[model samples]
Target: MEVSSQHLLSNEYTEVYRRLPLKLQLAYGVGHVLNDVCASMWFTYLLVFFHLVLQFNNWQAGFMLLVGQVADAVSTPFVGFHSDQSDNFWLCRYGRRKTWHLIGTVCVLVTFPFIFSPCIGCSGSHQWAQIFYYCVFISIFQFGWASVQISHLSLIPELTPNEHDRTKLTAIRYCFTVVSNLLVYVITWGILHISSGEESKIGPGDAPKFQHVVWTGLSLGILCSVIFHVFVKEEGALGSSDVRGTSLRTPIADILRSVEVYQVAVVYMSTRLFVNLSQVFIPLYLHETLDMAASALALIPLIMFIGSFVTSMTIEKLNRCFGRRLSYILGVLMGLAACIWIKWGSGDQFKSSQIHIIAVLIGAGGSITLVTSLGITADLIGDKTSSGAFVYGIMSFTDKLANGIAVVIIQDLHKDPSNTGYYRDVLTYVCGGSALLGALAVISFLKKVRGDPLGYENVPNYNSINSDVLPVATEDIQPSLIS
Candidate 1:
């Protein structure tokens, strides 16, 4: 009996992996890498580019980012809703979610070059022109990114039904994401170091170097998209053909009516708020407190990548051992401690010896918090009644909202350059406070979700009818035929 049980478990594992085509798995992994590379590089360095290279004031730079995130907040959920409703969209050809993916890819390709283009002329009026250009391009980029990100996230549950497999797959994707972040750090730092011939360059007229870096990123984005499209095969839609139109009012009503979804969204938003707020301050902290050069600042992402990579590799084991809720609490507490240490204990000292150690601690703790939270999101989605697209859309929207709010708050708080000490203190307070709140929310939600295991019994299964071989019902096809 023991041997038979073991054999059955092994077979289940094999079947889980086999559910996704090998090419699709590779494409998914590669797509994550590309996505993070673009996102991390731009987000981490864009403020610096605007402030140091383009000569924008810190508030202006922060506000631009704030605007972009606001745009993301508005667009993500709307797109997800539309995509979820579109029955004949491209992804339906194979019953897979490929239509939105392809559309998102094309949008990225189109917007990428414009993102890199130098908007300001070399003449006297360049500064204002550059600002105008930055705002436009950044908005466009964010819009396109929202479409891609929401659709990509929505695809996760569709890709696999097994909970354990989903966890493993998520880990693999995060690993690739970390690697991409590391590469961006190394490459961009090298470029900045080489171009400036100094530790950091200041002023607005230095547009050429900035343009080159943006172009390089654009090129990489193009290559990554191509690779993803070539390898990934999205699964067609599953189950019954009752094409019921999802009521637009339902999502809003769900938001108001479902206590569970509201609680989850709040936790998600609070956690994101804490993380993003802290991230915005890292560069400033490095610059002011540690006196680190721009090249060294690049090491921030590298450290974060390493931490995220390690945590992702062992996430399943960690989840199994600690349980997701307790794990998140532990991670958030650790991250909070690190932030406090850096802010109160070490901010004034500015020692090179302490910098690396602090970076590692922050990175490790941040990674654990991020991964555990994402895992919880997957769990929540699995438990919910909504479609995969809608769940991800809601999550994405909440995150963007948090980010937008964080940017505005941080920007307003940090308007005065002379009061660096106060700024640091405020950041510490805000970030630490939010983390604490998120931990509390996680604890509460854990009580509600404690007994559930990842499974698909709750979801409708369409595979029994051989989704791939079934002919798509067209307008001309008789409804009677399908019945």
Candidate 2:
């Protein structure tokens, strides 16, 4: 009887951790399309909508973004914590992560359109009322966004244990993200071009263009998510055990105490600050500093996404060849060069062609940095699937909070929206400075990981992994989880 039981257990273990099928990977990759599309609008267009179409000043626009970020930051841990415990919830029988994903998806689809739509029952004279109205919806939208983001990201660690597979998954997921961003920019460019006038500045008349963009994004996101839920399936809650024969659920206290955790977290956070802040300011730079037509807003970003799409497609091979840290530094340097060009080479003349090249650099740099940072994060998580959501939650907390505070500070620097010079300087410094800092953080992270530069030594052997279901107590998980 004992021999038979061991044989059955061994078979189960092999089945759970086996290489993921191509279809499963593709499904998992598409799962984030909802968040990606909405986020493209949120980061790229939120400020533009508030400041331009709704007539909020720069401060007010930045404040709205801050509100959403705070909400997202606050909600992330709760959703992550609860998601890790989804096995206990009856409603999560379909899947703990998917249940939260469904809830978040519903919240986003319902509230997101209203965010870009007219502030019903409030006119331009009632500025505070409109602000309050937006605050409510933005808060809800942000919370939902966090839920989707945390759950989806946490799924990466849960789905596979192979480092190469994890890298592939992360790379594939990013490709879909790039595609989502491309779709949104295309939709926005087409709508703005067809609907709006020849004027460079976006005005109240362009409100409907934004509405069309959000709805189209929401609709496409819905379809992708449906395919995700249908094709992707979660195994049993305890998950495949590590080769060390330990439980998948490492204690939260253990995770928090690891130096490696903080290392990857910093890299992840700095990368996000670089990507998001640059995205927020890019449109404003084009419209205000370059004095390009409104179409430039979508066209420039469209070009950038094209560059990112190409990078995402090829990054897996680059990562295999160059290693994570070197690849990340390469991306950072590219972004820094773009920032330098923006600050000096562009000059006062509206040289549209040169700016498009700069856009490509930004996009390519952003793709490599984001993918490698996330790949490093998955390496950090390894087989600790239970706390994966919490780890991601904490990382996102720092990213969103820092980004919010940064935006508020940057926007506060120039109270007047028409003051393009200060804003221009701000963009160059924030984006360039962040990329440099992120590169430094990556270098620092390697030193902290002891002899394991790639941090792959922490991962257990996949072939011998067992799923015996031994959940460790906090006191039992030693600090050596990192070393």
Candidate 3:
């Protein structure tokens, strides 16, 4: 006898998996890999690239990074606002998100050549010219990055309505991200080795070598973008005809009017500020204080990759056993501990190997912080609104903005070239303090929602008259299946 309908509902979930389109499945798997590789490559290695390859001073390098991040911050929100306003924007022949993805791919292809171009005939005052070139190229690169990142992230919740499926999907995406992180670390190390002769000595003038490496990376990035565009499918559309026709001004007003949006935005901004400050300083600490080789510096990302891989594999279990809020809190606390260790511990006591071990532990904590916080942002948006694209755009903007401010603040703080030791000490204190403060803020927010499992109070009803004002909910929204 065939199973009854109720029995099938109760016993089978594999059917749901089978129902997903082949294109979606492939895109889901590949997108994360491509995004992680491309995104991390710039942030993780660019500092060293500028310092060693470009021969820029620490302050100068930091400022350049600051500029790129600031540009990212400004551009992301505008993009988000525009995206929310447009209907079938990505749906014109090519998929909705796919069109932007292709555009970003082309942008990367065009920009990579500039990044790798040699310092030939660049003498006298043209030193500034070289710096200007690098900065502009990086800024443009980030613009393309933000476009692809915001659009792609916005696609996630729309692809599936099921809360459980979203979590599962995010986990899968993170797993690929880990793999990409690892691949880039290995590849970057190899490229530097081949191009530099000595890992520590490569500077800005080796344009030919840098160009070769960047071209290869850019080609790979373009190929991945194409795969993503061709395979990824956006499943849902904005429900209301009015919403579809809504001017960009409407969503912008709506986003601005929402209080929860600002609250989430503040949290994202503060957290990113704290975390990235620490991240930016890590290479500086390794290079100046630890006097480590570039090859050794690569271990930082390698360790982070491993930690992310482990987290990706076990996130479901962690979320199930400990509620998402607690899991998130734990991750933040872990980051706090790592920061404290690096800040207060005696550096001279540890050998190079021991230092690397410490770096790994720190990396593990940082990995946890990154993955959990990002998941929380998605959940926060999900609990509050059905408009996934708009929410994701807000989150992305907050993160990038925070990064921009943090880079500028840290760079400005470390402006004195004469005091290397003092600079390191200051970086340690700032990073440690920021991490602790960020954790506290997150904890405070979580405390408000401790009793409310669904956090429904956090969601504001747009139809209400006072809806023009975003409200802070009395109860924190519970991290739940809906989020």
Which candidate tops lDDT? 2
Candidate 1 positional error at 78, Å? 1.1
True-structure RMSD, every candidate = 7.5, 5.6, 8.1
Query: Considering lDDT, where higher is better, how would the candidates rank from best to worst?
Result: 2, 1, 3
Model 2: CA > 4 A from native: 1-17, 197-199, 236-240, 244-246, 347-350, 416-418, 450-483
Deviation (Å) of 467 in candidate 2: 23
| TM agreement with the true structure for every prediction | 0.81, 0.89, 0.79
Cα lDDT of model 2 by residue, 1-483, tens digit = 122444345433333345567888899889999999999999999999999888888889999999999999999988988888846778888888988888898888889888897798776547888999999999999889999999888888777655666788899999999999999999998888777755656887889789888888888999999998898887532233564566677677777788778877788888999889888889988888877789889989999999999998888767766678788999999899898888885554436478888999999999999999988877777677777888888889989998999998898778675676765687688888988888999998665663556533333323233543322222212123342
Clashes of each: 8, 0, 8
lDDT of 3 by residue, 265-324 (tens): 665665565555655666666666666566655566566567667766777556555655
Our model 2 lands, by Cα RMSD against the true structure, at 5.6
lDDT of 1 by residue, 1-483 (tens): 112344334432222123555566667766654456557745676677667765667777777788778777887877777666646465556433456666666666666555444443533565667666776777776777777777666566556544444565676676777777777777766766776555674346556655665666657766777787666655442211222322222345554455666667777777777666666677666676556676666766567567667766787566656667776777787778766876765543445556566566656666666666666666655522234566667777888877766766676667567765654675578777878887888777667555533211122222465333322222211111000
Question: In candidate 2, which residue pairs get closer than 3 Å at backbone N, Cα or C atoms, i.e. clash?
Answer: none
Pairs that collide in candidate 3 are: 52-203, 53-203, 53-204, 90-96, 258-470, 259-470, 455-477, 455-478
